[model samples]
Target: MDSQSRVFAAILTESGREYTGNENPQRLKVQAVDRQILNNRVQEVQVTGTAEDCCPADRVSVRVSVGHSKDSVNEVTNSVSRRLEYILQVVRQHGASEKDTSVRRFLHREADKYHMDAEVLITFSDFEKMERVRSVLLEKLAKSVCVGTPQFYHSAECLSLMRRRACVSAVENAQQKACEVSQLLGQTLGHPFLVREEETREWKNEDEEDGGRCQNATRLPHPSQIPTITVSSQVSVSFTFRDISKKKPQ
Candidate 1:
């Protein structure tokens, strides 16, 4: 359906008083000369707009663990430590940075048998390399190795940047719509009185198809196939509904 722009009386107030109208009055905020004048003024316009941005999901967190069983606690711990070190070295050779790998070892005693488990958290941008690492570790460690599922996510810096861009886009949309309507009515657009966010959302799209290469036995989803991170924002903006052309010189 086609949309229509409207003109409303500009009322700037912060009395926290409840107002009754078809729209939410709390969102109608603006700098005013006087609250009494704002309430009495009859020129105002309301505009609501929405915008979104999609960023590629390049970062992924992969958790890998190895469990070893031996007759003595020392033997299990030593074996697990050696295997963990080797696994880390393999990952590093495949482009995983040392700063992104965190290792933790757990030892437990069950009767005469001792069990030791070593786990590592690896964060990187390459999904294929991660899968290769997982496969090679499983090949060497056999039954003692376990490759946990990789959880996909984006970096903080990327998401923050997208959100800010989306906000600007939403405001621009509102401004364009407002300006068009005001011109048609012979009124010049003024400074925005209020811009309040009505909705902010973040989500990942997982419906993209990558030509039968989405996932494999390593439990790593194809980065290109998975949905990218998306940010959306909706805002209700209020602008002064008046004319700059008819102003008198001071």
Candidate 2:
């Protein structure tokens, strides 16, 4: 057997996007950008799980964005606060399960003379039932906050939890493929001589402002879904091949 070996590397990826909107140009632009990023980075795979049509059954977390003139921060805050309260009242009226609904994060910033942004995150267990809540909020903002639709995202913690399983599966798949290739090379595969697994997360535009100066504001599709975590594995495998000269005499 000689100490020479040939290795090959392969990768697999998966992704998803969830959103709902009319034919608004702005919305379409956002959707297109989101699709482009995902298509370029992700591979098609059968992901089991209903597209998160509504928030999860457990408490769903939501982010609300509000903006106003810098000089009007106080006014904007007051108005937005009142509007939120009204929204809460409406949710209560609609039988929202308040036990799971609460404020999660808040941010306020001054961008310019005519730009002040405030953001609030609300968490609730029953997101599917929030249609009334959204309607009430829109109605409240009609006369006050000059903001667009409040974007919703599955919490980071939730995503990490969900992806962990997928990551494991991807790792196993990579190993199997590596072994298959080793077998096809006419050699007995040995322990991995070297293995490298890498994952890269890219967003459309993480530097965009979100109601305020968001460090990385990615305008993902309605589901605020990220392209599947691309788990790439590079393995340098060593295998033993019998030397023809050393073959046993029949």
Instruction: TM-score each candidate.
Output: 0.70, 0.39
**Positional deviation of residue 129's Cα in model 2 after best superposition, in angstroms:** 3.4
The stretch of ten residues in a row with the least summed lDDT in candidate 2 is 44-53
Query: Lowest summed-lDDT stretch of 10 residues in model 1?
Result: 207-216
Clashing pairs in model 2, backbone N/Cα/C closer than 3 A? 18-223, 59-124, 59-125, 60-124, 206-216, 206-217
Please write out the lDDT profile of model 1 over residues 1-250, one tens digit for every residue. Answer: 1222233433334664423355675676644455455345556578887888888776777677778889988888888888888888889889998888999888888888999877888887787887788788777766666666666667888899989988878888888888887877456777887989878899877743332221225665554765588888888889886544345978
Number of the predicted model whose TM-score against the real structure is largest: 1
Clash pairs, candidate 1, are 8-43, 8-44, 8-45, 9-42, 9-43, 9-44, 10-43, 10-44, 205-227
How many Å off is the CA of 68 in candidate 2? 15
* Segments of candidate 1 deviating more than 4 angstroms: 1-42, 205-216, 222-229, 245-250
Q: Could you tell me how far off, in angstroms, the CA of residue 111 lies in candidate 2 after the best superposition? A: 25
Which portions of model 2 miss their true places by more than 4 Å?
Answer: 1-86, 93-121, 124-128, 139-148, 162-166, 188-199, 204-250
